[model samples]
Target: MTGILRLLTARRGAGRLHWTDWATYAYLGLAVLLMFGPVLWLVLSSFKTPAALLEFPPSFLPMTQKEVRVEGYPQPLPLFSVTMEDGSTRELAQVRRVGLIAQMVDPKAPGTTVRVAADKRQPVREMAFAVSNYTEPLAKYDFLRFLENSLFVTLIATAITLVINSMAAYALSIYEFKGKTLAMLAVIGTLMIPITIVLVPVYLVVTEMGLVNSLWAVILPGAATPTGVFLLRQYMLTIPRDLIEAARMDKASEWRIYARIVMPLSAPALAVLTIFSIMWRWNDFLWPLAVLTKSEVQTLQIGLNAFQGELQTQWHYLLAMTVVTLTPVAIVFAFLQRFIATGIANTGMK
Candidate 1:
């Protein structure tokens, strides 16, 4: 009992943190803000009107100008309060047909209206929500078509990627072959070569294959990636050889073992690869831009390019479409993120 009390007291003495720990926490807080601040701004800005978006000294929260329609006004006029030369204030009533003259009313008197120049009117603006920014783009632009194309390409490409990469990783990890080392080296070698260096050749091949202007041109070329194979192979190596030998002792076919044993055990790795593949295929711009020339078949990223005119950009629509583009990837990450954490932790330990 005396020894236990001494050990507890020592732990209590060491539990108190110094200034460095607090400083580290503060730094991490700032880093997190810096990372997510723009994303928060993008989401908020998607709900703002064009006029509100262009306001000087930009607002982080979405807002719109306040307006009211009076008895004789044909359109809604901006609401304002007028302060007269006599230091009396009146609520906005209406504007005159002539010059910048605005009519004002008194809250105390129901039937009272007064005339004031536009200079004397202090405009009032209130927080306004603009949901049309999201809806209008989908209605005016063929955003639905672009969204469909993006989904089709992302899903198909990711599925193919998982199948092909997993098979390759399985072969390299489990099966003994004469040239297995060379094959693994070849896969790793491709990673050192930048995609930009092969862009022209890839485009030409797609052109010769008659895949240009088609979604297949985008999907086929990226169906298999070296990084996916490497990731899955490394994770698969951590699985014990005893399991595979035991399955073989049971007379399980190689394909059966791969499908039933390997796949289920590698769920964490597959989840990680699924997220990576989805992000790549969904956000891919250059390859899709090079191959898909038809407006009807263009991906969301390419379709978003249409908003940028030579002189002016439709920022409201651009921001809204950007939010739309990011939604699916965000959702996929949300669901599969735990798997990713588990996979990385296990892989690192291995």
Candidate 2:
């Protein structure tokens, strides 16, 4: 917390700001606005009504027309600020509208109705949040099941990816053998292949294994990523060779050396890889969509399709669920982000 405060209050070298400081602060301010402005808009819009969302001039605040109940009125009437002929404004409840004129009534005097031009009246609105945008969907859809499926796929797949990639990296970095360079090149080579190119073949293979509509179909195929292997391997190369030799002289097994020494020392790199793996598995859409067809097993990304339809889409609900879906990834990144710079910088060392 003190570190955060220091960063937030940082200035130019314990003295008055220089021109460069002004430029740097301006650039940083713009960058922050560009990054977080849309996210702020999305969170606010998720609380807006359908009509307010469709308005031509979008409002930053969630606003709804104020309504009031008057004596002898069967329903609540929308309140409006009406301009009278004397050029004074009065707060009146709108009873009905005909042509360009609105019949306005004073809530205190229900017997008299005053007709005012629609153009002369503005809606009396207040900041209101439509909580139903979030509530209705949870009540109507099987979000809990979708959440479970997504959590299962993301967690299991990430664990498998880390284990497999770290093992491959350990072998590649620690042992020298025939075709080692070629194997490393081939692993790195897979990064060039666009995911779209392999979707069909991967789907066919998954079908052959009879894992369609299964969470394993999503988890197993992406268990070993070349990127993870390359990152971990490069970082592992920086580990001193003497550490392994000393472990061997101590009668420790290869697995013990890998687990006890290599793994613990490679903490930063592992954290970076873990973050990548979680994001990849959690946000994966097309592959999960192709594999999990059954509603019972569908992940959150696929389940978001429920809000989209042939005729109309529920943007409010979609936006709300999207915020919900982003929460876990944000939390994970927040916790693990400190390792990114350390891991990436050291990976370049021979």
Q: Per-prediction RMSD in angstroms?
A: 5.7, 1.8
| Cα displacement (Å) at residue 13, model 1 | 9.4
Give per-residue CA lDDT, model 2, range 1-350, as digits (tens): 99977766677778887777788878988999999999899999999998889987999888988999999999999999988999999999999999999999999898999989999999999999999988887778888788888899889988899899999999999999999999999999999999999999999999999999999999998899999999999999999999899999999999999999999999999999999998998899999989888999998998899999999999989988898888899899999999999998988733
* Model 2 residue 136 distance off true place after TM-score fit, in angstroms: 1.2
**Per-residue lDDT for 264 in model 1?**
94
Best by lDDT: 2
Worst 10-residue stretch by lDDT in candidate 2?
Answer: 4-13
Those runs of model 2 whose alpha carbons end farther than 4 Å from true positions after fitting are: 13-15
What value does the lDDT take at residue 119 in candidate 2? 98
Error of 1 at 123 (Å): 2.0
Poorest 10 consecutive residues by lDDT, candidate 1: 4-13
